[model samples]
Target: MTCDRLVCANCAAPVNEGRCPVCRASRERLQQQEGVLGALTPAALLVLLVALVAVAVLARSFAG
Candidate 1:
């Protein structure tokens, strides 16, 4: 849920534009909340999928 597309109810404008104080504050809060997980791009997801497959293979081999 990024704030880039959020519409501010205070001024009936886009939050990213910061049309009002409430919109700016809400945008800032959303940005801070997404700071951590927001950086997980497609490449990171691909790497994580590969790691999961490798782990699954190892687990199956050990079980057998």
Candidate 2:
């Protein structure tokens, strides 16, 4: 649940836009809880996953 999809009940706007104080505070809190990888887009994370799999496959091949 990224902030991008969150709705601000106080401002009636998307949380990511932070239209009001409440929205801003909520966005900040959510971002903090999400950590570093949580900020990454789905596509970027997918690429990372693929890269990790490739690395593991290469490592296994080398070890054998």
Best by lDDT: 2
lDDT of 1 by residue, 15-57 (tens): 9989899998998888788777686787897999999999999
Candidate 2: tens digits of C-alpha lDDT, residues 1-64? 6788899999799999999999999988987898888778899999999999999999999999
**Pairs that collide, model 1:** none
| Model 1: worst 10 consecutive residues (lDDT sum) | 33-42
Q: Which runs of model 1 end up more than 4 angstroms from their true locations?
A: 41-47, 51-64
The whole-model C-alpha lDDT of candidate 2 against the native structure comes to: 0.91
User: Model 2 off-target regions past 4 Å?
Assistant: none
lDDT score for residue 53 of model 2: 100
Error of 1 at 1 (Å): 1.2
